[model samples]
Target: MKTLTLAATAILLTAGFASAQTVRIGTEGAYPPYNMINDAGEVDGYERELGDELCKRAELDCTWVKNDWDSIIPNLVSGNYDAIMAGMAINEERQKVIQFTQNYVPPQASAYAAMSADADVEGGVVAAQTGTIQASHVAETGATLVEFATPDETLAAVRNGEADAVFADKEYLVPHVEESNGELVWIGEDIALDEGIGVGLRQSDTELKDKFDAAIASMKEDGSLNEMIGKWFGEGAPLFE
Candidate 1:
């Protein structure tokens, strides 16, 4: 919500980037591969690396700020941060509130994990993080949707038998399944949801959005964006053409 003064606007127009002030980039520090608090207590992961590169390319003085996923948008709208790079999907519902840079991550499937491969994915109780596309989808599907405040809680619901399955981003669920030692398995076919993940910006901050959009485009064209995606999501993840 920071507005540039006329002199600052002139400088920004000449610079061709949102450089009038430090752009605060908000992210959920709990989502791994997308973003997480590392051993050093600093934000780390794919979005962190991508955000740094975008800032470098855009010539924007930027800083990373951690926010809970459920309130991330509201805080941004309230000017708690200037942009969001928290693996948020670009969809019609979100478009009504905020602007988005072109997707840095491509459309990917969501998967259901449960204790048994035969677990009922349709009619059984399923857990999903609150305010997520997966949560809304599970509510719409035949499954009895159980909501949790955090991604870990959704998985815990499956682990503790509170829910039959936990539905989430396939990449987000892979590490848990692999490390589950046979306790968790993919229960059903993957479900595609949302358009893709992008950097969310305030609707009024079109200049900031344009700066990030151009930086994302440059990375996409140079293949560095795909490289970072693979580094985090694994080589099997889909990449842009």
Candidate 2:
């Protein structure tokens, strides 16, 4: 009798564990359109909106956490966050350490400089976002790379003539350039570095990954994803037509 009761209790405990779901989403709140803080002191932007929708669709309790860009991956691996929603691109290197959900949006990259020739990068000094693909790309070119933690700092480096130009994603850079009072320019073409972006999870959490995949698919089907994109980039937003 005792053995049977113990087996039943174990089964119930396992069931309860299976049903438990709480996901922590991480983002670098410094990047606008993806994640950023407005004057209201609240985090607002594309990734935040999309993450809320994902949690609702998946029926999971969710919390948002702001993480520095360079530390996001490490925190996720340490189980500090269940997923990363910071417009993170899934690449071969990242896949080794984490699993990614389905792609959420079209891929886009951009390169730009100030309009004035004086702002032109000489001697190939370019500013790139630290820990991003753009930084890797510029480094490969053997350019004297000046790394910045935020988009604003990267643009500021170029605007102030501290660096030649900056390369990054179009989604965040376009609006910044226009709003910078002619301090920046959109270069001829965006550099294609990789495919679309997705949510990052620890390698052991395959069940959570499956949930995220289904939620993202539903979001795409119901046009919620499109709505969020338009909200951030506008109807005529480059890259999402």
**What does the lDDT read for residue 183 in candidate 2?**
61
Give the worst 10-residue stretch by lDDT in candidate 1.
1-10
RMSD of each: 5.4, 8.4
lDDT of each: 0.87, 0.75
Q: How do the residues 85-193 of candidate 2 rate in per-residue lDDT, one tens digit apiece?
A: 9978767778887889878877666565655645444357888889888887777876688899877798788777787788788777778777878666765566787
> Mind giving the per-residue lDDT tens digits that candidate 1 earns over 22-51?
899999988888899999999999999999
Estimate the lDDT of model 2: 0.75
Query: How big is the positional error of residue 38 in model 1, measured in Å on the Cα after superposition?
Result: 0.9
Name the regions of candidate 1 deviating beyond 4 angstroms. 1-15, 18-20
